[model samples]
Target: MAGFIEKKALKKFSPGEIICLEGDAGNSMFIIKSGQVEVYNTVDRREIRLAKLGPGEIFGEMSLIDGRPRSATVRAITDVECVEITRAMFDKILAGSPNWLGVFMNVLVERLRIADKKQRVTDSVEIGKKTVYLISLMLEKEEKTTGIIYKQSWKKLVEDISFLLDIPPSQVSGILSKLIFTPLAESEFNYKDGKTFIVKDWERFLKFTRFCKERYLKNITKGIIEEFEVKSEKEVKFLKFINEILKEQARANDIEMEYMNSKCSEILNEDISKYEKVISELVKSGILKKAVRDDGGKYILVDLELFDIKFQKYVDIELFENILKKFEN
Candidate 1:
C-alpha cells in the first residue's frame, strides 16, 4: 500500500502551506513520508490546536472512511512530502488487512467525532480572543523584516496559523474579520493592493486577549450569558448604508451631508428624521464626522483607522457589496 501510494499519488507541500481545510469535502487520506503536519480546528473565531503528526502518521482517514467533510484543517509545518491514499486504495487495503485494521479505523473515527463535538461547544468570544493573541504573535515575528503586512500576507498568516494552531483557513479568515474591528488592531482597506496593515502593540494586545479569555471563561463556567447594549436594527441599517457609500464611491468624503442624508432616506424608504438620528448616533460613535468644504459643510465617512470597534460586527460584506453596486448604478 505504501509503495502504491508513493508511485501513483505523491504530493508535496511547502513550509506554511495548507494541506486541507476543515469542513471541506475530502475523499483521500495522507500518510506523511517526510517533515511534519499540524491539525487544528477553529471554533467561534478561535483556533484550537489538535495534534502534530510527524512521519508515518495518517490524516484524513475519517473523511475517507465516512465520506464526510474534513473534521479539521491540516497544514505543513515544514516542507512536507505525503503519500496520498484514495478511497479506492482504502477499499483494497481493507480487503487485505485482517479484520483488525478496519475495526481500529472505526474506533478512531468515533473518538475524533466526540472530540470535535466538544471543541465546537467552545465560546466564540473566547476563540476570538485566542485568535487575537495568535495574530499578535505572528505580527511580532514578522516585524523584523516588514512592519506593514498586507491582505496577501493574510493568506500566508492563515497558513501559519493552520500550521501552528492546527486550525482551518476559512475559520482564520472569519476570525480576522472580527479582529479588524477591534481596538487591539488597526487596518486600512483602501491601499493600492487592498492590504490591511496590522497595527503592532504586542504588550497591550496580548493583555487584552488574556483579559477577554479569562472573562469569557468565567462567564461560561458560571453558566452566564453576558449581555450588553447593542445598536438598534435601524441604526445598524443606517451605518451599513453609510459604509456602502464610502466603499463604493471613492469621493464619499466630498459628498455633501445633506445629499447623503437624502440618499439614506431614499434608499431606506424612511423619513429623513430617522436618518438624522442614525447619523447623529454614527457621529457619536466616530464612524462619521463633519467636515468643512469651501462651499459649505459635508459629512465624510472617517478613514478605516477611525472606524468604530463594533462596526465590522454588524457588517455583512456580501450584502454591503451588493447594496453598494446597486447604489453605484
Candidate 2:
C-alpha cells in the first residue's frame, strides 16, 4: 500500500539503542528481517525480561487500532534491520483485500474489545489518583486477594506507599492519616511489608464510581439529544459571534486565523455556538473581561480564581475541593 518507498528515510538501528519504550503509542508494526531485540519491564525493583524477538518475526501490531501504549519496552540486542508497516499503509492494504480485511478487522476488534473490558474494570476501582496504585500493588502482592485496612506502624506504611506512588514518605503518611477515618477492612495478615489495608471497601467505592460515570454518560447523551431536538436560530447567531471573536483574537495575538477552528474545537468541544452563548452570558454578567488590542482585535480573558501571591493563599479552596470531590466520588 506504500506505493512510493522512500529509501532515504530508512535507517539502521545501532546496538543498545531503544527501539521502543513501554507506554509509547505504537504507530507502526515492524518486522525484524535481521538481528535481534529484547523486550522487558521492571517489577518489584527487578528487571524482568519479557521476550526476545529475532529475524523474520513481527511485533507492535496491537496498537494499530486504538493506538494504545506499548506494554513493554523493546531494545535492540544487536544491529538490526527492520521494515516498518505504518498504520495507514496497513489499513489500506487490508481494505483492498477482502479475505485479509475480514481477518484483520476481526483480530483488531477482538483486541480492542479485550482492552476496553480491562480499562472499564480498572476505571471502576476507587481510591485517589496516586493512592490507587499502592492499593493495586498491595492486592497483587497478596495473590489476587482483597485488602485489609489495618492500623499499624505509620513509619513503614509511609515508606511502602511512598515508593508505590513515587512520592516522599512524609506525604504518604499525611495522605494515609486523612483516609484512616474512612471504611477499611480489618483482616489478619503477616507483617511482610508493614501494615496493610485489607479493606473490602474497594468494591463499594468501585460501585459508586461506576454509578457516577453512568450518570455522567446519561447527562451528556441527554444534552446531545436535546440539542438535536431544538431549533437552532440562537445557535447560528452564537456561531457567527464566536467566529468574529476568534478572528479578532487571532489578529490581536498575532496568531493565524486558521487556528480558530482548532481552538474552538478544543475549548468548546467543537460547539462554537454553545461556547459563544456561554461566553456572551459571562460577559453580560461581568464575570469575564474583554480587551481591544492595537491591531483592531478583541480578546476575552476570564479570571477563574483569585490568588494571594505573597501569602500563597487561594480565595476558593472550598470550590476547588468540591470540584475535586466530584471526580473522587
| TM-score for each of the candidates | 0.36, 0.34
Residue 124, model 1, lDDT: 42
lDDT of each: 0.67, 0.54
- Which pairs of residues have clashing backbones in candidate 2? 147-198, 147-199, 148-197, 148-198, 148-199, 149-197, 149-198, 185-199
Q: What is the lDDT of candidate 2?
A: 0.54
Which pairs clash in model 1?
A: 39-166, 40-166, 151-195
Q: Residue 325 error for model 1, in Å?
A: 43
Per-residue lDDT of model 2, residues 184-211, tens digit only:
3343346675555444555433433333
Q: What lDDT score is found at residue 161 in candidate 2?
A: 73
Cα RMSD for candidates in order = 14.6, 18.3
